[model samples]
Target: MSRIQANLLLLVIALIWGSAFVAQSQGMADVGPMLFTGVRFLIGAAVVAPLAWREWKQLARQGKTPTATDARHIGGLGLLMLVGAALQQVGIISTSVTNAGFLTALYVPLVPVLSWLWLRQLPHWSVWPGALACLVGAFLLSGAHELNIGVGDLWVIASALPWAVHVLFVGRVADKLAAPFLVACGQFLVCGSLALVYSLFMEPVSLKGLIAAAGPIAYTGVLSVGVAFTAQVVAQRYAHAADAAIILSSETLFAAVFGYLMMGDRLNPAGFAGCALILGSMLVIQLLPLFRMGRHKPASVLDHPV
Candidate 1:
């Protein structure tokens, strides 16, 4: 895809992801967090599996079969990614949409930290300020004035750790895998399988919850995981990974907008101020080098993490 096309696709992905926050928040009213995750992931897997299969067929038609070792490596990477998605879904339901959105976006900055720790890869120092800005944005966006981090907030934070790992690996898998579709398929299958096992062993899968949450669950599975995630996979193919991460991070903006427009959420003046700060912080991270130092190209390999 051209850069413009990639950007447009990524924008749509961000929008879907943002809107899915609304679904996740509402879905929690009717289902247990883990159960909701299981159902949503299963649905997402079902939707994406066919696309991946078709993609594989296309590769076969072109007489291009990946080596067995390559397939296995990609599958393993994908499985790890699925685990991250499932955790994020479960975590989102446990937390507020704003908190979930901002905390999740932290994975973008967290990517470099993890890379530094695991691979000894030193991202330029500029990423530090962006990391700080993301944290401040999280605090503001979560409205953490009360200083009482709830159970849900803790869950969201837990979700961030795996998210960071998944993102780092996504950058890896995207670079070598047979495009995004196969990677997405393998990832969702692992997630769905784990969710199914958890549902059977830990929680009772209630038909009542499924019946009640049908709409929200479907919305999340289809738009959030299916369409949005697919776009993320394909879009990252072209944009600088950092730029992609920055663009995808705009899901917070979409979530806030959808919250207000769809659910009649009202933001007080204080909330509005906090929102502005988060937006400014994200923009600064994206445009910092462009205006100031004129340092390096923003195209870090870690761009646009999950």
Candidate 2:
């Protein structure tokens, strides 16, 4: 797929994830965060496993089957995903969703910085301003006026680092493996199995609670984990990590829109402005590369993976 197509897929992933935020919030009512996360991803793994099998078969035919090193790297990616998701899930228990949203969005800027520091890949110049705009927009949209440092806030902040690393790692491994579905399946299995194992010892998990949370599990497992995350893995094969981060950060905007429509949440003037800034930033970043295409090439981790 082309870069533009990849970006559009990332945008769709954002929409699915944004809309599923409500289910995620409501899901914890019946079960512990780890249980909910574990079950949902296990379901996601089940959903994707067939496709991954097919992908593996295809790669094997081409003599490009995954190596032990590839399995180790994919497992690492899963561990990062687990850490980030677990932190955000646990943090949201003590903090307001508004704070979690804004704090988690920090990954937008973190992705490019980490990519530069680790991969020595400088982003297109437009990514800096675009990422800043996305961060400010997320803050405004979150309706957080003052900086309040709470324990939960710190957890969410901590989640952003792994999330940023996860994005970069996905881009690198996906590009090398050329097997997006396989990557998604491997990560899901690793993350889900580990989480479920931890939850078994740490949290109470009853069938009754699982049934109560079934609706959320089905929605998030099927859409958010199964489809959206797999799409992200595929999209990042062509899209730059920095650019994907900016686009995916718009999940906050979609979350607000979904909240307003479904939950009767109202957005004030600041929220509207935040929406505009986010949209503008996404457009600017996408367009800037095109404008410079004739003169200079945009630097991307996908183009020069370390």
Candidate 3:
């Protein structure tokens, strides 16, 4: 793809993902959070599996195909996403849509820190400051409420930490494997299976909720889980490691916008300030790469979805 085309693809994907904040916020009104997430992911897997099938067939014809290790790597990646996404969804149940949106976005900076701590390498200076800004935003946003740390908010923070790990894992996985196909297969199978299992155990979903929320459920299942996820897989291939992190962070802004438009939720002054700081921190990390002074990953060469 041309540079403009690649960047545009990533931008479009980011927009889809960012907009899903609305779908998720609306999804909880009709269904239990666990049930909603499980259902959406089940739909996600169904949509993505076919995309992977063609790639698998092409590789089979070539004979020299995916190694056993590659399958295991994919398994690990899928599992990471499965756990992180599940937690984030469940967390939203207790938290306000606004708080959840802001808190979960902390993963953008957490990625580099997690990488640094795991590898014994220092994160760039910007990583620490950005992470701090995220925490402050989280505190400001969540602190305004009763401050009764709900199960859902706790779940989201847990999700944020793991989501950071998932981001790092994506970089490695995209580098080692045929990115889009591997990502599609992993998300399809793992999240799909886990969602089904979780649905059976934690959330015996009622037919009424499903019927009442069909529009919302479908929006999330198809657009948020299926299309947005596909864009993430493809875009990650063409994004620098840090750029991928920054792009994904746009979900918060989109979330805020949707909240205002759909829910009549307007941020207070403090909230707006917090949001600005978080966004500014992310932009600095993404746009001022040299300021961070780290060895960033280059965009991967991968096939784009039509």
* Candidate topping lDDT: 2
lDDT of 3 at 17: 64
Residues 1-306, candidate 3: write the lDDT tens digits.
443454566556656665676677667778777677777777876777787777777778878477877777777777877787778877776666666776677787777666567744454455566666755654554344546767777888788877777666664565556647556656657766776677778776788888887877788778777877776666666554444565566566666667777877677777677667756766665555454346654333332221
TM-scores of the models, in the given order? 0.83, 0.95, 0.82
Writing each residue's lDDT as its tens digit, candidate 2 over 146-196 gives 656689888888999999999988978978888889999999999999999
Question: How are the candidates ranked when ordered by lDDT, highest leading?
Answer: 2, 1, 3
Regions more than 4 Å wrong, model 3? 1-11, 120-125, 130-149, 290-306
> Candidate 2, 68: how far from true, in Å?
0.9
lDDT of 1: 0.69
Assess the local accuracy of residue 116 in candidate 3 as a C-alpha lDDT between 0 and 100. Answer: 62
Give lDDT: candidate 2, residue 84: 92
Candidate 3, residue 193: lDDT = 79
Local accuracy by lDDT, each model: 0.69, 0.87, 0.66
Q: How accurate is candidate 2 locally (lDDT)?
A: 0.87
User: Model 1 over residues 88-144: C-alpha lDDT tens digits?
Assistant: 667765566776777677777777777778866665555666666655655665566
Query: Per-residue error at 183 for model 1, in Å?
Result: 0.8
What is the Å distance of residue 172 in model 2 from its true position? 1.4
Task: State residue 164's C-alpha deviation in candidate 2, in Å.
Answer: 0.2
Candidate 2 wrong stretches, greater than 4 Å: 297-300
